[model samples]
Target: MIGQTFNQNRPLSQSLDTQGLKTKTRSFWVPLSIFFVITALSITVLGPQTQSIFDTREHIVQLQQDNRVLVDKKNKLTSIDKSLLTRQARIAVSAIPVESSGLAALATVRNKAFSSNITINQLRVSEGESSEKDAAKEVRLQFEISGSLSDLLKFIDSLSKAAPLLRIASVKMVGDGVTISTDLEMKTFWAELPVSLPPLNTPLNQVNKKDQDLLGQMNNLKAESLGFVAPASASARENPFAPY
Candidate 1:
């Protein structure tokens, strides 16, 4: 009877121990699973917002850098002499005019020919060809002139240094010992200025040594007319369409 009572008590104790272990395991696993679920939810909800905040910070830094560059450019521009800039602008425009018409080029040619003692018998102006849309537009000028061989040679040489830049495309000459008749085809170029400026954030490039040298070379170009013209010699035109 005593042995059976001891055996029954041992089995009851073992059953209690198993129940306690199960309760402890349930408590541990329940909290662990809940922690994992909360972590997943937090990543899903806050990941995009965190990334957006980081991107915004990077953009702000980039804008700050751009602003600094623009301010530097503005300061440089403000410090420059306005008169000097104006003079340079004039020089540049005279070198390559804005009008596609060959009026400036024609004037230069006439002035040079007169100075060289060459007589222009015939002159014609026409448009030139361009391969690119935004390329410089060209104006073609054809000339028939007669002069002494020496004078004709001097006129051609002077054309190289004249402003409203001219390029002699083809030249043909027939001489009779004392006088020479020449046929000349020349080209002049013009381009339109951009109507709009770049964005405010764009960095302005300072004129470097190469650009300064180019400007100096253009400054050396011979202007078409340096002497004064008498304004009183002007004649009024009533009808340009009327035939002579």
Candidate 2:
């Protein structure tokens, strides 16, 4: 009965209608399409430039990993460092011992003269602590030499070249030939400089010996002159040239 009533009330074409319908468009939809188009264009235009920047950054990092500063640049960097730490450490270690080595130095000096066939007379050794202005204690010597000019010259060269260090203060000479007589006053430095020096003509030899023996003599004579009774303390302070 319901099916008959529906068929009667409505036309059969309307009940099964497939007709087109009118539609309304909103303003937001148009703007939204334009926004998506602008977004796509920006990504397309900016993509390569952004990727190029990233690639450049990666190149720099890879180069840094593969490369090192040149030797000249490294030296310059070392020079720019303000500490001078290695130099100061060397000075402190090798330098501090020169103070008490005057006696051994006198022995070595006289030996140099003797080896050169020169005669040393009126040898004298003296030592003094540094004044407030000097910042370094100094040990000094004065003596006379009678020898050929060549021997005298050689002696000077030898002292300047001596290990454990020596410095000349003044020189006086008379006679030009083989019979010349010269007077010299010289200075040396040590961390624990000698107070009073031993007499000259000691048997210390600098030319040949065990390194330890040479150092031992130097150290012993230094201690004797400076009146330092302690050895353990000194041993603890690093040797300046120790395997550097």
What are the models' TM-scores?
A: 0.75, 0.40
- Put down candidate 2 lDDT per residue, 1-244, tens digits, no spaces: 9999988868766645533221233546779899988888768867877888899999988666444434444455456535654443444445345437676566668667766888888888788667775356677888998888888898888766553456788898999666889999988676644467443322222223574454443443211122234555445548856875
CA error at residue 237 for candidate 2, angstroms: 48
Off by over 4 Å in 1: 1-25, 33-37, 225-244
Poorly placed runs, candidate 2 (over 4 Å): 1-99, 192-244
Q: What lDDT score is found at residue 98 in candidate 1?
A: 83
Q: With candidate 2 superimposed using the best TM-score fit, by how many Å does residue 109's alpha carbon deviate from the native?
A: 0.5
lDDT of 1 by residue, 1-33 (tens): 999999889989999999999997987897889
Identify the candidate with maximal TM-score: 1
Q: Candidate 2: deviation at residue 52, Å?
A: 48
**Whose lDDT is greatest here?**
1
